[model samples]
Target: MKKSLVAALAVFSLVNAEQISIGGTSFERVDALKAYEVGCASNDADACFEAGWIHYQRQNLNKAIELYTRACNANNYKACTNLGALYFSGEGVKVDIKKAKELFSKACELGDGDGCNNTAFLYEQKKDIKTALKLYKKACDLGHQIACGAYKELSK
Candidate 1:
């Protein structure tokens, strides 16, 4: 009966236990931010990206930018794309289309479809239809559905 009771409690706990693993440590959902932060501090690229995303969702853009920069430097494509998006949208930082283009271009070269799509957007904004069309096609080929639609529209 004691064993059964212990097993029942364990099951109950697991029902509410969403876990995030960082650096071989498992953290519960409520502790995910701290876990990611710890991992980021240890120079884990994926952890930095996760922490950056959490900070962004929490409206802590400066922290997000810092963490994202670290991850981006480590060649985390998602981090580069996300940082580029922040610069592109002027969210929490002044709009810097130049920086956005550089970051997005880097991510595209790293094979992220969103990066290609975003780079195409910057070119489109500059009225460089030919460049934008080429990038949009590349983005579409890379599996960004939105870019496919944009490419179709531009083709017309």
Candidate 2:
């Protein structure tokens, strides 16, 4: 039994080594992604956010949602924004307008500009112009240049 266990451990190590070696082909980005994944698994919100970004880049929206959810749950503002976006866009999950609003509010409360911008857009679509304007202003104040431009265009 001990010998078998030792053999299993060796196999596991070998697998890990091969995985790492494969990553070494694009070492900088791959290593960074691995580190972020590990950090996310270890309950680091920022790391979870980073891992979500990696998944997003790979167009793995479901995986991105999973990591973003973890980060949002851990109080990462950007992650909250991302989660709101996922709900709003119906990319990784079904559209839940109310849930998207809630997540956007959470991100906005945490001072995420992107969240404010997205929330504003949602409000605008609903014809809640006043609320949309307010959120757009907030996003602009937060230095989200795109929001500022959008608000300007819409106000005209």
- TM-score for all predictions? 0.79, 0.75
Question: Which sections of candidate 1 miss by over 4 Å?
Answer: 1-27
In candidate 1, what are the lDDT values of residues 41-94, reduced to their tens digit? 777787789889878977999999999999999898999999999998999889
User: What TM-score does structure 2 among the candidates reach?
Assistant: 0.75
Candidate 2, residues 15-130: lDDT per residue as tens digits?
22213222223234455566667666667788788779878978999889999999999889999998888898798899999999999988988898998998898899999988
Reference-based lDDT, each prediction:
0.83, 0.78
Clashing pairs in 2: none
lDDT score of residue 36 within candidate 1: 61
